[model samples]
Target: MSTAPTLIFTEALVLLGGAVVAAPIFRKLGLGTVLGYLAAGAVIGPLAHIITGAEEILPVAELGVVFLLFVIGLELKPSTLWRMRADIFGLGSAQVLLGGGLLTIAAVMFQLLDWKAAVVAGFGLSLSSTAFALQILNDRNDMNSAYGQRTFSVLLFQDLAIVPLLAMISILGNQAGSQSASLWMDIGIAIAATLAMILTGRYVLTPLFQIIARTGAREVMIAAALFVVLGSAMLMQAVGLSMAMGAFLAGVMLAESSYRHELEADIEPFRGILQALFFIAVGLSVQFNVIFDNLLLLALAVPLIMLVKGLSIYGLCRLAGSSHNDALRIAAVLPQGGEFGFVLFTTAVSAGLFSNATASLLISIVTLTMALTPVVASLANHLLKGEAREEIEEDFEGAGSDVLMIGFSRFGQIAAQILLASGRDVTIIDDSADRIRQASMFGFRIYFGDGTRLDMLRAAGIEKAKIVAVCTQKRDVTDKIVDLIAAEFPHCRLFVRSYDRVHSLSLRARNVEYELRETLESGLKFGRSAITALGVSEDTAAAIEDDIRRRDEERLQLQAVDGLRAGTHMLYNRPVQPEPLVKPKRGAEQPEDAL
Candidate 1:
């Protein structure tokens, strides 16, 4: 007898197959994973009808958002958040308030639904996709750019505003008979629930993770991670608040924990897959029949909404001190609808704020807007590609020296400064606008751009330079710059900064001649201080440090040839022969030259 395939099995196949097929293709086409997942869901559920109902998948997939907020929370502690007060409160608050207000007015003028419904639509559309925008910014290496910071600050504010908006929705939409609990009671429960999660994270969860980690089982650790997420989510849901918000709070509390990095590493893959599923569910929710019936309407409405949102955000960015080009970049990248659009829309509808038809239309428009983000950002980038500054090009034209520094971060700055003080003409090219700006304040002619770019190197006169020093400790980036210079400008001497012994060996494997572990020298100096603090003579401590340094350098040089044998020798702490230092008595005077 023939048996029907299990529904779960079929659904899983459809979801996985869709993602597997679409992700690489869209990524290859430079559209990014957001569009890929969206397209997959559209084809599977809406068009092909392979997976007809996304209802069962959506609630679990919604946890994707919870995980995302959790990760975001981990990255932002109270102190870090305080330090960004200007960006968060000033720029961020302005974007949401202004964007929401203008949209509300425009909707009211057009007589879209009514004042109440317009309020929902206004604040709803004001949120840009955090995941999408961050991905695009990181891909372009612009997350540290002024525009990038501004856009992120605004996004952060929007994420926070979700809690207040929820409370507002419940207040406005709760009819007399429909109320489940008093507003004050619900508020109290929410507060108590948040506190409980924080306490549990600090006292209960940390110990629990510590115990679980000792088991030495990968599955147990993964299980523990999932337990924390789902447990916190359930606790929050029990208290009449957003589950995702509770997860975010839990993450914030755990931000200071020693296990944070471990937890993050475990949760990241799950977040990505679950988030993809969430996007897929969004795609499945699209009603193609309705879309096709009003294709022309959507075609116009989508662009209109995107234009309104983009210009509104751009204007706010400009008002907040972004340059014309920077404002354009922010506008182009953030005009799209956010994932929160779906969340708030569902909440709005359940509260009887708008009809299903209106919701569907808005959802369609938002999806289309998100799909067009990459195109919009590319065009905006093109618009910002003005000719290289005359002053910059002219300065680079003649500024060839014996020294070329590839980074201008804290590490690179010290190296560049020492060379500059010693009368060397050093051209430092850095990718960070912040670093470059700070360097300019100190009268350094630091150029801002990626060192890996061949044109940038040529402009910096890499061919004519003598020493190419890559002082950035990011091994991947350091290795890339090292490869570029070694291949094209082999005559130049290369000095690289490594994070540790392994990183140094990796650089050595790449045939890098000069590699200094970033912390090794400072650590040695600190070691000398510790020796002296224990009552050893300063001269003896200094001599011991010198011997240690000399032997380590000798080992590093030996390891540069074949790393395998030499690396093992260094790793095992093989003994080195050296003369014992003679300590001076307390009454004795130091040598005159040493003094």
Candidate 2:
């Protein structure tokens, strides 16, 4: 009898019901959503035993990781990865090698397995859970943080290393030179597949996106994006590489494409739910029998492993130039084992390098780590309270705005209102934490920081910005920022808020294209309204107001020139010379003769 439909339905219910219940509970308990997702998986897999296809669901769940890698790759330009090459190759390599080496020694001492099995176990367990770490870092908006970036570089390296690691496991299992040759073959195929993806992405994907985008079909665009990710992953998998690796490579290749943002937009929804499913699968796969039977060993193993890995990562991050607090965060965030340990342990067992008992114990330990990841992240974040710069930066990212307003004081509200009214993408940045909070309460996504900083500007997408309006109250501070913006981002149109007549003159001297005196227009409006209220008709009042504005502008223009002259005179250094204009009567009279 064909039971495929029934099986599928049951699996769907298990996943759906779990998610439906877990989200609210986790939220109410003030736990991370990941905890809810994992709980759902546990409830389905271990508690109700609703589905008999956890293993089948494993591969399906892995699609989330694949999509996630692809999306991460989209974020990682070659330049970004290259810039962090030291961290990737240095800290990342050492994390795997030294960490694995230490773990292997510990495993041997504990008599967990023979040296060969321990070696495999060590390498596998040394990896931090990428999904868990990135999810936390991303949620907290620490993706660009010093500690977050360094730790992520290590995670990325670990992702890349999975290919070789898997190959190594296979070779070790067979204990054969032939397996090594097969790996070389796979590597060649992997290279070819990668090149194919790049070339195809460069030539084909953008055009496809454009055609679909023109049709205005959201569903088609999303389907096309899915195809791209899944296709790349499948191609890589077909060539002896992980699907995530392939998808990631594809994503990186398309990072700079015109369609990159659109692709991200389309793919994000799928990646989130799928990634959640991937986490749920991890929870579901946790073996209660193995844990209960070997409770003492697993318990002893989990804490020890986390401690060693934590210390190792902390020292490594410190060596990489992170602050002590940041190092503590990096350490705590990454001590947990990764999802790949399951694959590694399975490969080892299938290859006869490890017995069923050892594999079960190791898998349990890995699952424990995965389950505990959110708690660790929460604790780390709590300990680093009043120091959540990562989260602060993250809130700005979601705005993905085109216009960045540097100050959110009363002056800033004018530009903000205009932009908001016009339905323009607008983001506000201010140094005052209290002001930022107030704006947030009033439904503004205000980024709190000293906006004059280049790092802050970049974080707010200064490069991609169309307009930047500086409305800070201080003239000198405004001028300093104007210079920075002029120097760094000449393409951006700057609209600076001037404090008064002198500030406006200063701005004009600086060759600012747009300078609005803070009180000039408002004071003019007050005069116009008063004139109309006194006796004049509204139209006559407007005419009189316009005429007055013209005269004042003419005077202002003359004054601006004089201000420039005055500044030049102040800075002037006359050469040592005879006293000027003692008597020039004959030459001075020449003006009449010339006329």
Candidate 3:
């Protein structure tokens, strides 16, 4: 059979079969679907050799990476990128340069190759798999944590850096005069094409999307999104750039558009399928025979690469202003070689710039490193846990101030400032090293510790504190802290930030006082005031705001009472009763009907 037909059939069968069989098993084991896909590729490609034509399968797999980049671009707004410039530029740049340079030096010491080859190898191995790392972090619900955000910023920068690195590699290859003036002309054309696409995407795509959106046709919207990605990718390829970069640029153009969410929703399914295939294809391409042959080399290289990358990351984090412990954790979490390394290694090998033996050795090392990242990250967490506990204890011992702040985030920072300016002896505790460093720079008395830990709270002078503000973002963390404070420091008044009605009730259940839903109350008041200012009837605006406030308070009370008894009281544990559309007569309404 022809390669094209074989590829199409294998892809469809593998995707469908893999999802049905592998997904549940992976979930049960608490591993991600990406691992499942990798396993699937191993079974189909190496074990059974069912997917016989890998060369044909690869281009299709490449699409998955392209689409993934597109989605990443969509997520990265200019403002968000700007906010993370420190992480992206400082830590990220350092990781690449230092990690790569160290690896190059190691390669030379090993007598593997000349300086140029060693440099290429170093650059290839410095990147940690953004796909794998991010997926694991997201699965563990750590994406919102300080370490997770820092890791993500570094990964984002690496993805952006790939473009320039690839360009340089191409330029160096052309310097050998393998191709004529056509090579340089091709490079210039590619640069112009990429630039033109970005300009057109920025100026024309949004309005074009707006016009398509007027049709209110979901299919057309999806088609348009696909067109932008595929069209740009084709343009990029025609001019000698990677199609992935084009798709990424197209995604960035749509980042701030009004239809961003719509485009995302439309293309998400395609992106997911393609991305899974991409990972599986990576597994398929892993030459297991070669890996087995070089088992000793693989074993040695894996740990060495990880150690080098980890040390580089540690130094970078410290330079970026993280504390010693935090720097260690960040370094430990990002020691693996990334997906891009696989791509780069394969490209260099195909171009005859890397020896078969060297390429095989590098691939084996990269794969092993990638596989071990989760275990390494978990070990890092374990090591840091002891230090974290000790720090919490010390912070609690030092506590006994007039005011205790549970979280030193943006909201807590402001609260801490006002309290301190008013001459109160304030002690702040936060889990984020980045935030703690900022606080230290500004001369705030802050301790690095989890507020949810009862011992930490006690050590933070919670018992003696006049007020304890639970100003953290996570509702679960806030609730735990409130419960602990209520149990151990009953005299201290607790003020907490509630994200919504649900969150307010969670706090209220623990008998937290001064619960403030950051948005609901403030938003209602703002809307009402705006209407009143716009010549709306004062009575109407007042009535609306009052109704919202009343409903909010009532819901909080009902949820609080229900939450207290749900675990032990059968009556409270009954399935939730729906509220009436219209308010019932006062006397006719049950106590539960108030909310």
C-alpha RMSD for every candidate: 11.3, 19.7, 7.8
lDDT computed for candidate 2: 0.80
Candidate 3 C-alpha error for residue 586, in Å: 13
Lowest lDDT block of 10, candidate 1:
586-595
Which scores higher on lDDT, 2 or 3? Answer: 2
Model 1 lDDT, full chain set = 0.77
Error of 1 at 408 (Å): 9.0
Off by over 4 Å in 3: 1-11, 79-94, 114-116, 140-175, 178-187, 322-334, 385-595
**Residue pairs in steric clash, candidate 1?**
none
Worst 10 residues of 3 by lDDT: 582-591
Instruction: Please report, in order, the local distance difference test score of every candidate based on alpha carbons.
Output: 0.77, 0.80, 0.75
User: Of models 1 and 3, which has the larger lDDT?
Assistant: 1
Q: What tens-digit string does per-residue lDDT give for candidate 1 at 447-533?
A: 766788898888887877888889875778887888888888877788888978777878777777688888888899999999899
Error of 2 at 316 (Å): 0.7
By lDDT, the best candidate is 2
Model 3, span 350-383: residue lDDT tens: 6656887887778777777766776686677665
